[model samples]
Target: MSETRVHRADVKTAHQDLHSERGALRGEHPGRSRNPLIKVVDLAWLEFEKPDLDRAEVFARDFGFQIAARTDRELWLRGTFAGSPCMVIRRGRTSRFIGPAFHAPERADLDRLARATGTCVRDTDVPGGGAAVDLLDPSGFPVRVVDCDRALSALPEQRPLLLNSGTDHRRTNATQRPPREPSRIQRLGHVVLETRLFARALDWYLDTLGMIVSDFLFLDGRRDRGPTMAFIRCDRGSVPADHHTLAMHLGPGTGYVHSAYQVTDLDSIAAGGEYLAERGYRRSWGIGRHIQGSQLFDYWRDPDRLMLEHFADGDLFSCDVEPGWAPMSTSGLAQWGPPATRDFLGAGPSPQRIRDVIEALRGDNEMDLTRLLGLLKAANS
Candidate 1:
């Protein structure tokens, strides 16, 4: 497939509307800012510390992330999002902050960012090869921005891995073989985070990045019928998108929350969920339509226990769209579900994963990811 690229389009200075002046550049968002023109990209990742390494691995594989490599302490998983690892299961319970990943145009962007932010920045070379830079944000999570070049190997099986053939007779062929995939992220949509300092977080994101609020949620904080959650867009003047790339909600935590990955369709979501179950993973929450964003979502736990979301058919807003606010309601968050639960938002690292994390953190002798990656490279060669 031809390369998928983010094109530049004339967008209004979000700062001009939000603030009093036309601050900063009237030119393209510094091609050297190490931040892509983000037209619309998936969150790219959410690293979680899993207690049960094996379980986390099984869970992510079932949920549809291609297991890229694994070590005694970490497991890496990738999806349709180019060569980017959509999820990483690190071995500590200490990792907080849901850092959103933005794909920039080139390494020069990172250089530009170092100068713009006046922060000493560096790149994390891929374990095997290539490199990317981690951009720090006000929230403490380092928003990783990269002009990446990673390759994806096709799925080994086309049939749903976890679902039984008995459910659909036509699926009998699934056990046979897989078909070739031409490569495209298809497209990655947006992500939502629950924040304790919702207003602070929302303002920081909007001011630093050129995001416009498309809509919002306000709960009964008295007659203050103001917003509690905000959904914003990266406004691409003529971009044909109906997806909000980022959203913030009022909540207890101040860390990196859940991030979303977009697939091709509802079929991919359903099939991937079943495949995950067949591969032996605990389904987190989903196969439900969220009321707020109006996106059909599926959530699952990866081997590292981080939440992985698959979404499609979500609401979108133009860059110039103003913020719309409504009272927050549990009943209004989803169109369908058995009702939300505490564990629904906080799915504990499973029994097995918790133990694995403890040992790894305690300085246990662990297998390294490099060995496994070496084996994969040799096999492919």
Candidate 2:
């Protein structure tokens, strides 16, 4: 039996006026930790590659993320996610893991963290209800801070749909569907990453972001197994969604992997996925339901080989109870869908004859080992 790990992490955070729309839920929940005000109300992660950064700028504008700043190296974008810039596209041949944007409870919290962890904390202003600082997590991801409440999604236009006395479906063609939305974005959810430091990375995220592990992926280290993935939560007060604002795992290499944008429903996820597909972008995996976050999702590969996703209508939880963990396996990751078919996305196919290659390639100074190794590995067995 897999040992069931228990997490009673100790925390330290500045005191604050815990306000809320329906009243601060944590203010009432018993056993809720009093300190470590780890409510991540925003995200400010980096995009590894700046390939077509201009185009990404256009896409961000079309998708509803406000442009905060753009130079040759980084494209900073903002949104309703919080007060600070929500996403940044840093110049690279491809995207790499930069880190997450977790906000602080107050200015004092920033000071406290800087004092406690010795991370180089910085401050900025962008999205929320108050000021913010940058938090360098234990795992080395850059976390931006802000004191804004996660505002409600202001969907363009909504009306109650009613089916009254013998409403004819065919005759309602003109007014059949809801009003059109131009690639509307509802909220910022979690980001999944590829990393080299697995356990170290996990602890860093949990400790810094206050993310409760909804589940952790385990691997048998055998067969053509699937990569294990983790799911986390972020309680934004008004909305009971912390359905993995971020997740991480071992990397083929390291850097800002990819980010996910949330829409209102599954149809929207499909719509966005279809739009990206029509534009000739590569898809990584998905357009299916994930058992962890329980969100309807679709995945795509961006210019830098990072997998981006469009997700919607994830399950909401108010129980404040984090539960579940599973071993990583080929068949266990996806509950339903075409089997994940990426050579590099979910998991590598199998083990290799490393000893033979190590001897053959010894002192081959002319060959670029990294490039040669990747090509050889990507090829047929």
Candidate 3:
């Protein structure tokens, strides 16, 4: 019998340059783990500390989140999905992101994670009673794995509008009139973070939570050094999951970049954007489709200047799908949109960012002069 073979040129498309199998053949990282503590089901919620609960509540409503629970000191925001609250904001002296909490499938999974990490599970006092095991990632970000007994019921759905396309008329004679209101967020989609210790953090998430990479992006001339960014998805076996539940990139700063929420469609994004604009909220960037996740997205800043995103129609991949690889560049961010903005890129000059660069260079982390220069080049390319 003849041997079977497949050529890269035969399978490669103009859009995709590499896949996990080929990357492994080239001696690149496999982007996953052989063994892990436990596989998390989904993101539970993100915690934040804001100075004013009143102001936060106002923005939360205007941003299309329903108030799940609120107190004088804390405010819990939820989406239309039947799950946990999307976010928990507490009163604090300064406004900053606390961390993210992921949902463990079973109580035993939490026990397994706790035992593996040498940490103990503690009871949570949030709206839904739960137990959580907290641990810090390699980059000093707090990560919590939780198992909650109670789940929030689904709210009324924001139905997508029917449209007429080429040779297809879904909407008969009805006029398209999406109301100018806040985009009703369905669920928390994903979060993007920047880390000075990219390699360590990336490995920690994979090994600890059993996450698998959906895509890997490397600097043009630094492929030998491995990927500088990864879009990671939860390991749901044969079940399809979001393309990325969490994304991390190499950068001088080690903190949140932006978090995204799923909306209905492009009409929701446009109408919701108008609502935010009329309310005098600042838009960072977006109203475009991204190449990686294929999400129609719009980015805005809350009153505290934290970046949040409204997105819809994101890609979903099963565990069988191997990670794709591409070169990182500003132009590669979107398939069709305005050029990446300085605010979205975090390229605008700021004293704190300058200090972060200096501190990262001085500290013993993955970031260095050459890597920083490579990132800057990739950002401006």
lDDT of each residue in 228-270, candidate 2, tens digit only: 3455665455456555677775433344556787666655555
Candidate 2, residue 219: the lDDT equals 41
Clashes of 1: 22
List, residue by residue over 39-66, the lDDT tens digit for candidate 1: 2232445555656678766555455557
Question: Using Cα atoms with residue i matched to residue i, what is each candidate's TM-score against the true structure?
Answer: 0.63, 0.66, 0.95
Predicted structure 3, TM vs. truth: 0.95
Predicted candidate 1, C-alpha RMSD: 14.2
lDDT of residue 59 for candidate 3: 92
lDDT tens digits, residue span 1-381, model 3:
323223323333322543332333377878799998899978989999999999999998888999999988899999999989989999999999989999998999988998898999999866879999999999998999998889999999778998889999888868887899999989999999999999999999999999999889998888889999999999998788998999999999999999999999999999999999999999999899998888999999999899999999998877766678888899888878888899999998799999999999999999989999999999999
Give the residue spans of candidate 2 off by over 4 A: 1-51, 59-74, 78-85, 91-95, 119-121, 125-139, 146-182, 220-229, 235-239, 343-381
Residue pairs with colliding backbones in model 3 are none
Task: State the C-alpha lDDT per candidate.
Answer: 0.53, 0.52, 0.89
Error of 3 at 293 (Å): 0.8
